[model samples]
Target chain A: MQKGEAFKIEVNELALEVTSHIVNSSEIFRIVFSDTRPPLVVIESLTNGRPFWTSVPQGRQKEAEFFGKLIEEKLKK
Target chain B: MCYYNGQKVSKTEFLKLLQLEKALKDFDFLNKELSTGFDYSLNAVVRPKEGEIDFDIVQMEWGFVPAYIRNREQLGKMRLGYKDSAGKFHPPLTTLNSTAEEMLKPGKIYREAALKRRCLVLSSGFFEWRHVNPLSKKTGLPLKATINYPYHITIKEHEYFYMAGIWQPFIDTQTGETVDTFAIVTTKANPLMEQIHNSKKRMPTILPDELAYEWIFGELSEERIQQIGSYQYDYREMDACTISKEFRASLDPTAPFAYEDLPAFELSL
Candidate 1:
């Protein structure tokens, strides 16, 4: 995906807003929870799927789990 | 410095252990997540109000992003170690662990956070690698090679302990996005940690249960902060063991957390 290409996906109770950024010649996909508190749950995944960096804010377990599963499902697709 | 950390307990268990079930009613984001490297986030307890030791745990990125980094461009430049010859924009140093000495020094990136924005990083255990060079057995000659043995360290008596930390809020000027990040405080390693973390001889400033309250809420001068930062826990109260090298390999969340009793290779002293 080109830099700034973004989209939103919703599955069941979780909603994710994914954005792409070009960092050092690699694409980093930063997927954040659309509905979350101050420290939102953000997953930074590489296009190659080698490194999946997930960040979950305090008090948002359900959102984090759903986000994780959604990323896994998307990767499979 | 602690790069990898493990928080094996659930939020309910952590709250019960810390006796914050009533004070903190709604927040339940903490879980059994393990970190192997940077760019990940962890939960930390911070005192947002003075005279109140009761605090709430918040998720913060492991690396501290200084406020001066206004946008993605600046972040990229800073990460690439960009700095003017006059020392403008600060040096490109790792923000994962801010040493106590560095925190006390004037004009340091973490000085303000050190004095004002202290917090407690909760962890069941932390990981560090020890460097060893051994002679070649086949050639019977000294080999020019070094092997890193990863160790998981934890307090002996406590299921979970607090490591002193400082946090900051960074806002992207362009997008107005905010991210809370933190850096673990480190001090001169105690006898045992010195042996384990031989290269740097630095260990996280792990506070005792009683001191945890003071670390978060107490008022003190720069000298007192330095003293608190330099305080060392007894090495006997801590434990360490070798873990699989896979801990250093990838960012897989499901990677094995098993500890090995012996190092993979024998070291020739």
Candidate 2:
């Protein structure tokens, strides 16, 4: 915890560098998957202090549901 | 920076502390088992409800933000370090841990807040790094190696505890926005911490629940506040264990990791 440290994580074989930053006065986690064919952008928030996706840009909403269900669970495990 | 866990704080227990049945709706709750203070992450803290003797459990940023900081731009510049007109770079002041002794001193950043904005940082356990120097294999003598052994320290049986803290209400001058931020107050380490957080030889003022209630709710003088701010928890009533170096990436960062060559210390009485 060095004041703005980034986290490295994987989701569906995609490596992501996640950093928490203030967004609209609340903290949010964001990642950009350059490895993807179109380069995906995924953003998430914690509700009731649990992680849930809030943004999956470029029409990936349908596929994002799969990742959103358990990011927090995956983190705790 | 401090790293701590904040999971499994009994809801009923927390409500009882605040005497509130249904406050804290939509709170970030600091529910993460492991969170990094470096991220300026939100964590649960108990503070006096505005104009009320009752307490409130709320989430505030872990890093202390001085009221003089005008905006988010200044905050970023301060944390990241900014150069002046002459190209001199000013490093960020460490906000993660404020020394209790100096908080009330004149012109200190924590002075005003420490006077009127005391709080309790709720924590399950906290992480610290110990500097362990190993011997050089070729010479079989001591080597100047920077080896940091991570440890998770907690109360003997309590699932959660509180650390003395001070908060400030920061206003973004440009936008007129505001947020409450705080820093964990640190005092000289007790014997146990002397062996664990060896680098700084300091530890957070981990107050017991009784003192926690007094910290946020009791009315006291400047001397009393300073006394509580520098209060040290008994080391014998605490526990410590080395954890995986790559704990941040691990599911259970607090899980004990035994070191083969780690020197064992006789618990300081």
User: Over the stretch B1-269, how does candidate 2's per-residue lDDT look in tens digits?
Assistant: 11111222333333332322112232245446786798988888888886764566777988899877889999988888889999999998769889988888899999888888999887878999988888787998878877888999989866567799999888888999878899999999999999888878899998876667677767778888888889999998999999999999999999999999887774646
In the range A18-56, model 1's lDDT, one tens digit per residue, is 665432123334566655644333343322324333333
Candidate 2: list runs displaced more than 4 Å. Answer: A1-77, B1-30, B137-140, B266-269
TM-score of chain B of each: 0.77, 0.88
Q: How much of the true contact map at the interface does candidate 2 reproduce, as a fraction? A: 0.00
Q: Worst ten-residue run, lDDT, model 2 chain B? A: B1-10
What shift in Å separates residue B160 of candidate 2 from its native position after superposition?
Answer: 1.1
Stretches off by above 4 angstroms in model 1 are A1-77, B1-19, B22-28, B80-92, B138-142, B248-269
Instruction: Provide all candidates' interface root-mean-square deviations.
Output: 14.1, 14.3
DockQ for all candidate structures vs. native: 0.02, 0.02
- Model 1: colliding residue pairs: A59-B29
Model 1 chain B poorest ten-residue lDDT run: B1-10
